[model samples]
Target: MPPRQSPAQKLAAKLLLGGEWAPVTNKIGFVKRPVDQAAVEWRKWVQRSNFQTRDGIGVTEHQGTLTELLSKLLPLGYGTRWLLLETANPEWTAVVENTTGDAHFQYVLRHHLSEVRKIPTIEVQDEPKNMKRLPDEMARGRWGGRNLTVYDEAGFRRSLSLYHSEPWKFHHGGEPYDFEDVEQYSAPRALDCFPHETLVHICRNLGLDPFEEDFYVPNGRAFIVELLHDGKRSGGKKYTLAEARAGHDDISVPAVDDPVIGNALYPSGSGNPNPDAIFPSTGFESYARPTPWDRAVKEFEECLKRYSSYPVRASFSDGLEDLGIIALPSLSSGGTGSTDISVMASATLLESPLAIREYTAAFMILQWRQADDSSAFRSFYPNRKQMAVIRRIYKEQGLYPFDAGSNEVYFNLAVDKMIRSVTELRLTKELVDWEASQPAPSTAEAAARANRSCAWDIRMHIQEREDEIWNPELDDRA
Candidate 1:
């Protein structure tokens, strides 16, 4: 007899609306909120299971609907990036993505049929500059960031002889392509069209629509596990790469095209460069090109705009009313803390382009706490240095320190100002870091300029989001 199926190894699995569990096969996953609800937890699961090397994952959902879902899944198998889309899709799973606003693309892949493709494909990017693999870079000729490559996946493989669409044209891989074919100007003749158009073209060419609802096996078991790791997600303090190195006491750099840097970071012959440096993609690939901090702030603002346009589907209760607190929704991405609290967990911004996930309850409790009266936080999470600042701010500002009688609105405004100063304070500290990296200044004038050289501005993260004080007439911006 076949060995009995060991009771589906007790994973923290569940189904929507309490669907029954059973010994299952043909497993697939639906990641509705991978970053917010699942990043750490799902990553932990993958670490334990080595899922990428074992069971394959696919984007069975059509690109017509699962647009953002496509971005979140890239990292699951060695590919993860917003910029890496054009290449990763065909090698991993096919995806179609089209979004309004900036940072957009229309692309698809059929990793399922990648193994079956007979013709080889090519992709040259703007920057193999952002990867740890130089060998891969040297192999895939740099297209000076501009490239014309064949679209070869399991579902659609073509050998188009080039007819000049722009500039000088060359024969398709040296052979003249037929411009006389009736369906010559086909949709997605290249990687420049929507998924629907591509699917239609594939339908005409391959005679199948994998996107049909019936194409997916019914009752594919679903799971809804409470995220196993909920501690704040944060990168370490911002420092130059030269200081974060493994040896030399510390230093680092994001390995890009520079061969010496790549060799230094990955050391030639190191087996399959570590995939943990940043987002995964073939242990290579640049997704989401690094934008300047100003652009990042714009991204954060756009994120806030789209999130309220489509609020998260997770279940949560603010507990603000219970604490008698109020707040404004102004927020920025990244973690925040009340320096006064040393032991209590602080709030953080979940990083994603599609949504903003944050712990606002901490901000609520923080918003209205009067000096010496916030025993809920102060008594349990006292930090001498941070609380001392709070005490000083309360006393020096000529503000009410102990009274909580109808002063919450005024107190919150005071706290907003305090956070503004704190944010400035945070940026101001960067000079110290800069000094550590620089040689001792020979002249006082140079020192003065260096003191003023903090490259970052206040993040404008001077207020809490998602928690609120509901006095309508007080702040019009709110």
Candidate 2:
């Protein structure tokens, strides 16, 4: 016969839930040792069982579905526990509770699938620029100035080619060229129709190098025009005649017959001038042409004009309210407050649309706060020296000093002031009602009553005064 099982070995039993071994706890109770012959026999038979078992201490069996086990385990904080089990099987269910500790584990058993499903493929388009990675020297300036010096020769070449393919031409009357027939003429041919000498004069007036090969070269004329538009020197200063002359010497020109002279030979009609008749036999290329800053300024102005056309309205409330919360059915983009308290208020107001307003407000507040912190005023503002100013403002307004660390100090103070004003107003109204209810008194008493009424009026007026110290109108326009 098999050797008699030890007390520790006989009590061990595995817990299962949905055909899977589950982690168990024995915090509830402890196991009892067998005393009689029948109890001992039962223990011995249990030890000989084929199922997996732990050192027999405290284990309880449970019977339930996986959903039921999860529902029980989730509230107990045993959701992340790992469980051990024997052979995998389906259509089995059980729940095992441990009596050793206040912790329990759950497990599920399932058959492995034979094949895996293929994931869908996706196509990605190439991105133009990663603005974050761009170096400080290469980055575009706030007012729309582009520093093209970061571009390599190849990049510059590609840009020049693009520029030439769509040359901005000028008509005989000095108006900008609007090609009625763009397909029939090359960019250089269209540009050649404009008076070259007149362009040279305009270049001089703009403080640009009129003699630069890039400025005269038919294909590269567009680049020179762009530079004249920008009005900046290579060193980023306002372009002067001296600077322009220096730049004119720096540009490299390819040897080719002048396109303007060649185009002049092509006459139109019977001695009638036809602007579209111009065409060059050979194309010329000019290199190292810089874009003009003026062109960028014009484009920015146009963008601002278009943006201004969009209607935007500003609304204010006594307390923070999300745009979504208002009963206005026409609101498309919702607004919310910057903080948690604001978020709660927004939720009450906006109901289902609170999420959108909360997101928008958070982003806007972050952007504004960042801008404020980064401003020059933050660095230059007097700290301790300004304490006197703050104290004066407080004394004049009869306001108590608040802790600077409090985030809602300003908002709370505003609300408190409003409440005080309302209370004073009600008190004054009561005083008036009392005076009206009383009978006419003696001269001295009447005089005393008048003084009391005037005092109340003064007090109410003081309380109703608005705080204008931090008004926006005080900001410098310059």
Candidate 3:
């Protein structure tokens, strides 16, 4: 028998018991206490209960499906998938409100895949140069705008090689030498055919030290000819007689059989010491022997002709718009701004192709706003009139204070001008309508209008006159 229980103990034990209340049976001749009865009832209640299921937590069945959807939807993880989802169904929030997280994910997943699929692979544009970590000079101006001094002699020589050699062959290493193989007799040798006298004359006139100086010549002809002259004067050979007349050879001295004077022309009378050999030997290499100099000059000049051109800033001309580059399509006479479609199309050309990404992004923002029904911009968008104003402003003023260096600023101004034009049109319309309704005034009234100190003063006087002449009842004033 359990210990006899008090009323308070029985109540406490009854409270601890989990299941419905039940009457306890007593064993024959042995009376059971209330606490023992309660214990028995609690044990029975525990036996009847079942374990709770592990749902709505980690690694659940729904999570696997959701993960699958996420993987399928975001294979590349490119672009704003949510914006694309919003585009597909504006009321997508309501559609998924009562649904599971997995259901909502599936809806987004389907829309994302569909959106990405529609975008042809060819439509993907390369990221702009300005977006990346480009060199300082690359972002400065057109390729031609870089300073000439940026190239050292070695770099210039390499660039020049591209002009003389087949560029692909030189870089990729083993294409046949073909046209640049100057060893062939029939191959066009520009310097070899050039008049020696004329070449020397040009070199001298240009203040060049044909034997030792390196200068940037604009043409290959000049380059090859200059080098030929240098070769002719390589030894102690003077370019002219002592009296300063133009001639190729020095023949004033006698001949000798010395190995140092090997096979070279000397003055008459064999076996006499050669006076022409007065100069020290410059090894076997002469300025006349073509090795490095002629080749260097020819290649560099060819490169200059092939790779570089005079830098040109675009200018306005007939049939070409002077928006920035002079050779682009014109935006004059409300051309691109004549309609909403045209405005959207033409705004892209306002910036360079390399810098057009910002303009594209801004234009997309406008598009997104119009697409969203809840957006304030949907009703009061500044496309047509703003574009018209932009066109008019460009035609009248050109791109003021905007040039190659300020592309981002130019894009901002274009958008800002569009917004300002919308408000300007609204105000100008009000002013015009107000002016039309007024009675014809005397010359004194006209003079008074003209005599207003400023535009603000003029506006205030006009408003005062309108108030004075107001027929409140007829004008619908409430």
Candidate 4:
């Protein structure tokens, strides 16, 4: 089984973001391993200064003394401080540059230093025994001109002396000064003036720094200040905090009348009778409904019926025959009966050539059947003669072969041959059976007996031969 992960490992896995750093409550910073070159350089720098690393804690070598390495490094500008802090331990350095630290720095520069500078310069003596020290370094400078202050060790130390002054009072005048008076003469304030307390409030509002961590305060303070500054400005009206809050309430509050109810006086509920009601209060009214035109409707119905007519399945020959019928010229009524008959015959003859052969065969079969049923050949001679004449005329016109003589001969011969064949095949067996029933002892009877015996023997021999020839067992299996 695999090993179970520790709670800390599980948390670390879940907290892993795409970036190289772990987010802390105070600020965002990268993690630097002890073996990293950058970390080594930072360790060296810290060691060279008044700070030391002991048991994972960044301790000052001068312990309890006001001479902190970071305090000395702050005047060099925030960027330098940030770089050093990040290099020292990027994972934990956020504690210094966060919103809280930012605000604290701002308070020191803006409020504390501002108050200190109000002290008289003449009273800011190096020897405290002779004269009282000024609250800030600006007071220690020569009177009445813009005095320059360096960020080096001497300048920082001098600045510290001013900070150390009690209530920032001048000895000669016995007067105490506030931060406002001192800020008037001070240099431009640093961008990192976020206060720690303000940062805590901002973090709480954002729900990010619930632990009130000191490291994240500076970052939160800066974020808050930026948000406030960048917020949309009210057009012309300069709004106080109270006024803005009141205006927001006014915009969000509900109106007095209920919009769901139907009330004409109040102009609510779609300005009509209630939609939930089955019928309006005004009741129902009647209006004329127009009828469609009868002729137009009938014509449309007729067109629809025509379009829906049953489809007939036809071959190409059938379609061509139909086209011929549609293209044919119509007959006139002025002609005699014979002329009309001739014209009709010519038109029928011009119809599909394939259909004509089938129709002719059917007509011949019908005539033969009629002659057999009625034994009235003489009476039907006129019709038969007319057909023969027509056939002869068609043959003469080069429409068909002249085969009337062969047809008559073949028909007579077929009648006689069919009678003979049917009598021989069907009646021979009955005749033979009748002869076998006669008495014996006479010459005729003996002749008949001999013939019957011969026939029986021949039949028996043929049956035996057929049995041997068709035997299934005689066939080869292989």
Question: Residues 1-478, candidate 3, lDDT per residue (tens digit)?
Answer: 9889543233223221210110000000000112223222222221221201111001101112211222221111111111010111111110111110111122111111122222100000000011112344222211100000001111111111111111111111112223233342122543222222332333233232222112211121110000011122223211111111111011123212131321133211111122111112122111122223344333322322221122111111211121111122111111011211111122212222322323222232332222123222333222444434433443344443323223333343333323332222112334334434434433332332332122222323323333222334323322
* TM-score (C-alpha, index-matched) for candidate 4: 0.13
lDDT for position 326 in model 3: 14
The digit string of per-residue lDDT tens for model 1 on 173-247 reads: 222233223343343443232122332343323322223332222222111111111123211122112222221
| Best candidate according to TM-score | 1
Q: Write one digit per residue (lDDT tens) for candidate 2, span 1-478.
A: 9888432123222111211211132211101111122122222322332211232211112233332322222111111111111111111111122111122110010000000111111110111111122344333211100010001112211000011112232222112223223333244554333223333333233233212322211211100000011112111112111222121211122212122322232211011121122221121111112333233323332322221222222222211221112211111111111111111122222332323232223322222113223322232222332334434545565543532222233332323233332222222444334434434433332332233212323233333443332223432313
- For candidate 2, the 10 contiguous residues with the lowest summed lDDT are 221-230
TM-score of each predicted structure versus truth: 0.19, 0.15, 0.14, 0.13
Which regions of candidate 2 fall more than 4 Å away from where they truly are? 1-345, 348-368, 371-382, 403-478
lDDT of each: 0.24, 0.22, 0.21, 0.23
Ranking by lDDT: 1, 4, 2, 3
lDDT of 4: 0.23
CA error at residue 168 for candidate 1, angstroms = 16
- State the displacement of the C-alpha of residue 162, model 1, in Å, after optimal TM-score superposition: 13
CA displacement after TM-score superposition, residue 221 of candidate 2 (Å): 71
Which portions of model 1 show Cα errors greater than 4 Å? 1-156, 159-183, 186-199, 210-230, 234-478
lDDT of 2 at 222: 7
Deviation from native of the Cα of residue 321 in model 2, angstroms? 12
